[model samples]
Target: MSIMLKEMKAGDQGRVQGFAAGGQAYRRKLLAMGLTPGVEFLVVRVAPMGDPVEVRVRGTSVSLRKDEAATLNVERMP
Candidate 1:
């Protein structure tokens, strides 16, 4: 099953499943940031206010806002 990125906790692992809402430019930007489907990532951290959450992907870390991440679908991994 797929879950929203905003629902994931730190140390969680998952694969990019798909996006929920985004225009062409937004989609392209996320793709450019390496958030394409099938890519695997690990939740690294969540800010105190929970606005931006960090994930480790492609050997680097990327931080995304909760609203943006809420549009993301991720299949959790064991």
Candidate 2:
């Protein structure tokens, strides 16, 4: 069960599965920010309107816009 990263709510835990259809440059940008495949991350917070989502990965918090997050595929942890 993979879902878009933007669909995850605050406190959700998941691992990066891959990415949705998008540009390679965009994907590479995310990879450089530590969102590579198989990386486990926790959703730290979501804005009231859900524009910016904060996730903790590799011991650091990264904020992503909704559009940016939508390109990521993640599988929630049990």
Candidate 3:
């Protein structure tokens, strides 16, 4: 099953499925950040205010805004 990226907690592992309905430019931006479909990522941290969520992707850490993370559809890994 797929869930919004923002809903995932730290230490969770998941694969990027795709993006939710939104802007093409935003999609392109995310893609450039290595969030392409089928890519796996590990949730590293979530701020106390829950504004920025950090994840390890392609061997690098990326911080995404809450709304930006929400736009990603991801499937939890076992």
Candidate 4:
């Protein structure tokens, strides 16, 4: 089953599907950060409070807030 990016924990891997809900600007921001569809990424870490989480994507690490990450639909990979 598909899951929201925010549901994943560190070491989890998944491929981008599409945005769940966001404005054009927000979506553009995600895309600019390399969170485009079909891209594979790893959940690198999550803050103690679980506010902002870091993910490894396209050879770089990007930090995204739970709200923003939640909008990202993902197909978890084994």
Candidate 5:
């Protein structure tokens, strides 16, 4: 099943399916933040209120806001 990036739990791994955000700038920012398609990512943590989630990708830990993370579509890894 596909899910929003923010909904993923810690230790979950997935491949980026696509981004739902509009405009090139938002897409670019997401890409720079390591949300590119085909890349695998692991959810590291979710803040207490769940507004921001941390993910490990490209050997780095990146934090994403709930709204921004929602734009990313991902499928769970087998």
Candidate 6:
């Protein structure tokens, strides 16, 4: 099923479907953080209060705010 990036739980892995926002710069920023569409990522942790979420992508850990994370659409992996 499709879900917002911020909604992913710890240890959950998914492939990026798309970004909610449309813009070259926004896409570039996400790409810079290794969050390119079609790339797989694992949710590592969610900070208390859930403002920021940590994810493992391309062997690197990146933290993103809920707003930013929400922009990403992902599908849970088996």
Candidate 4: misplaced stretches above 4 Å?
Answer: 23-25
Give the whole-model CA lDDT for all candidates, comma-separated: 0.88, 0.92, 0.92, 0.89, 0.84, 0.85
lDDT of 1 by residue, 15-46 (tens): 99998866454576678899999999999998
Residue range 1-78, candidate 3, lDDT tens digits: 989998889999999999998746578889999999999999999998887999999999999998788889999998
1-78 per-residue lDDT for model 5 (tens digits)? 778887778888999998875635467888988779889988899998887899899999989888778788899897
- What are the models' TM-scores? 0.90, 0.94, 0.94, 0.91, 0.87, 0.87
Q: Where's the lowest-lDDT run of ten residues in candidate 6?
A: 20-29
**Global lDDT of model 4:** 0.89
- Pairs that collide, model 2: none
* TM-score result, candidate 1: 0.90
Per-residue error (Å), model 5, residue 62: 0.2
Find the number of clashing residue pairs for candidate 3.
0
Itemize residue pairs with steric clashes in candidate 6: none
Worst 10 residues of 4 by lDDT: 19-28
Q: Write the candidate numbers in order of decreasing lDDT.
A: 3, 2, 4, 1, 6, 5
Candidate 1 residue 44 C-alpha distance from true site, Å: 0.3
lDDT of 1 at 15: 99
- The better-scoring model by lDDT among 3 and 4 is 3
Pairs of colliding residues, candidate 3:
none
Model 6, runs deviating above 4 Å: 22-25
Task: Show model 2 residue runs off by greater than 4 Å.
Answer: none
